[model samples]
Target chain A: AQSVTQLDSHVSVSEGTPVLLRCNYSSSYSPSLFWYVQHPNKGLQLLLKYTSAATLVKGINGFEAEFKKSETSFHLTKPSAHMSDAAEYFCVVILSGSARQLTFGSGTQLTVLP
Target chain B: GAGVSQSPRYKVAKRGQDVALRCDPISGHVSLFWYQQALGQGPEFLTYFQNEAQLDKSGLPSDRFFAERPEGSVSTLKIQRTQQEDSAVYLCASSNRDRGDHQPQHFGDGTRLSIL
Candidate 1:
């Protein structure tokens, strides 16, 4: 079974400051990792995906994540935080054999202060 | 529609009542999925469908929960004898199977079910 753990349940950052949300995964085989964001009363929006192509994956809204195989981590990062970045972020994994279902982390709520 | 569309954005039902949620995936999408998101938690997989075939349903919580994609374009999730524990946001997503598994699934706004 594959699973993901989000290190922080909540993260707060001031505007123009760097933001980091940690995530770790346990999988038997190579995993497809993704980051998704959801605002209140809205749908989950894909931020970025890492499919073994590049270790450093860039996503929309100036977000990016680095897939570190040795560290067993896929941490999301942003150079600067904006007020609109306040939302719930999730780390998801797809196992090698079963690509149908997505295993999601508990989630990390980001709060951006002005 | 332009994206995945779910009906009855908000539903309030008494306990023991039966409720059904609908999902219309993007046209030509070969894969559809259902997930349950409880308050303060990430969404959990409930079921999956490939075209019109119901391939995997290992995530269904109970026998009372059922989902079907009769024609492959639209899907429905029905819950019988609803319990308070079943109250959550039901999300529907679809992806192009031919595009490979790495493709991100597009999600709907979700149907919030409140059981009383």
Candidate 2:
């Protein structure tokens, strides 16, 4: 079975500070990884994805993630956090041979301080 | 529609009542999926369909949960005799291509189902 674990349940950052949300995945085969962001009462929005082509994947809103096979990790990072960046982040994994099923992690809520 | 669309953004049903949630995927999308998201938890895969054919439904919790896509464009997830545990947000998503191509799935604003 494949799954993703988010290390933090909540992370608070000051405006303009760097932000990091950790995620670790377990997969038997090569997997497709993705990052999604959700605002209150809103649908999830795709942030970035790693499909084995690029180790470093850049996404919308100045966010990026690095996929490390050896580490089995795909952590999301932003150099500078803005007020609008406050939302929930989910680390998702699409294991090979699952017929396009997505396993999502318990989200990490981000809080940006002014 | 420009994106996936879900109907009845909010629904309230009594326990033992049957409820149906609708999902309209992006036009021409070949694959559609249904997911269940509990409060404070991540969304879990419930079922999948490929062009009107239900390819995978192993994630459905029980027989009370049913989903269908007749023409491969509009899909519906029906829950019979809903229980309190079944009270969660039902999400629908669609992808441009099949599973092997690794296309990203677009999500809809989920239908929030509350069972009283």
Predicted model with the maximum DockQ: 2
Cα miss at B88, model 1 (Å)?
Answer: 0.2
lDDT of 2 at A80: 100
TM-score of each: 0.97, 0.97
Candidate 2 TM-score over all chains jointly:
0.97
**DockQ, each predicted model:** 0.70, 0.76
Which digits, one per residue and each the tens of the lDDT, describe model 1 over residues B3-72?
9999999999999999999999999999999999999999999988888888889899999999999998
Score chain A of each prediction against the true chain A by TM-score and list the results: 0.96, 0.96
lDDT of 2 by residue, B71-94 (tens): 989999999999999999999999
Candidate 1 local Cα displacement, residue A24, angstroms: 0.7
Off by over 4 Å in 1: A97-99, B98-100
